[model samples]
Target: MADSFLRPAVSTMRSGIAGALIAVLALAAAPTIASAQTAAPATKPAAKPAPATKPAPAEPAKDAAAPEDPLPWIKICSKDADKKNVCLVAKELRSQEGQLVASVALRDIEGDSKKVLLIAVPPVVLIQPGMRVQIDKGKQLEAKYTICFPNACYAEMEIADQAIAEMKKGKALVVTSLNIQQKPMAFPFLLSTFKKAAEGEGIDPNAGQQNQEQLQQELQKRAEEAAKKLQGGDAAKPADAPATPAPAPAPAEAPKP
Candidate 1:
């Protein structure tokens, strides 16, 4: 009976120690398991994209209109103090300095079949050689120097109907003269509007006087533009003064013999 009681007590003590060990192990592992379950998940990185290219610029558009003519042919009609009708189809060219380069006119008198081609040139030319005029490559005509004024020397020739017809159909009227240096100088006058101007009615006697201011303004504008172009469009510098016109001859004054 004593041996049986001792064996039962020893077995009861071993069972209690094993249960305590199992409880301690479960308590230690509880925190690690809870942390793992509540923690956030890691994220993957995004891929990079390529850059875009830019487009090129466009070009400017061109102008379509034609340029205007600087000098144009004109016809003038007036009565002299003597009460005689005088009509002239004329063109004049001048230098930037306001000096006259050359002037050509076809003078017509009422009740007269004879028409005169009057030309005025600078006094620096040789009067002995006279003047030569040609329409394009056609026949050349000779004109004699009739008189010399302070500003210009005059030359005149009688023009026939045939010459007028030829001039109407010509492209240019070329006037050749010998300079003081004995070198030949040529002046080409455009005949593009010659036919129309010759056939058209003459403007009033006061028309030129009325348009003088406008003409001066146009000349001034052109001079300014030319200067700007030469200076590479620099507008700070002022342009030179426009040239003054020389006094025109009276309509009644014909070339002397």
Candidate 2:
């Protein structure tokens, strides 16, 4: 009976031990299985694009690049101009045919209104490099100008002084037909800075304005002198003044009555 009991107890102990060993083996393999599953790398997401940069600002416009004014017109048909129907712009500096310094256009006012002269220069004129500026054509200039527009005159070449003298001996003025630089319109662009050059040549368009102040002073002086004379006033003479000589007899003396 004792041996039977002992044998059954030992067998029960062995079964418990076997069950514990199986549990230990399963725990040891659990980590390996987990590692195998983790070894497969994860799918990466697509990278986002970088932000765009801002653009720079634009540049400013130029001012001094403007063209020149036209040649001042010769005044015609004005009482101030001796009532002549034809006006003339005389050349102070003679221009040679190929000397090519500057070119100019003419703008004349038409009718009663005081505004920029409306006119055009034909492209036939070979004007020198210049600017085109607007000027008011008063009635003093003439009935109107011959060439007038935004840029009626185009490309003018300048000639040398010596060449100009040579041409003048032959009595010729290098006149060019009108042309356009970059457009279809017949506007006068300055082949040369004729107006600015004219200033250096001693033409003063502001003479009228200057005359007002000068004339006033002159008139006042004349009036004072006249008033003194009319009132029988005599300028104080110096005590050291020389004696006045008697008037000489006429070259051909007439017989007195």
What lDDT does the true structure give each of the candidates? 0.63, 0.29
Question: Which segments of candidate 1 are over 4 A away from where they belong?
Answer: 1-68, 81-83, 96-99, 232-257
Q: Write one digit per residue (lDDT tens) for candidate 1, span 1-257.
A: 00010011211112232233233223222122222233355445458644435434434443333223344567888787778788888765533322235668898888789999988765657999899999878999999999865555778999999999988987678777787888776666677678998999988646743443355467667767877787885544446865678999778977899
TM-score of each: 0.60, 0.19
On lDDT, the leading prediction is 1
lDDT of 2 at 168: 26
lDDT per residue for candidate 2 within 63-135, as digits (tens), equals 3433222222222221234442221122211011111122232322233222222222332333342323222
Candidate 2 C-alpha error for residue 168, in Å: 32
Q: For candidate 1, which ten residues in a row score worst on lDDT?
A: 1-10
RMSD of each: 52.5, 52.2
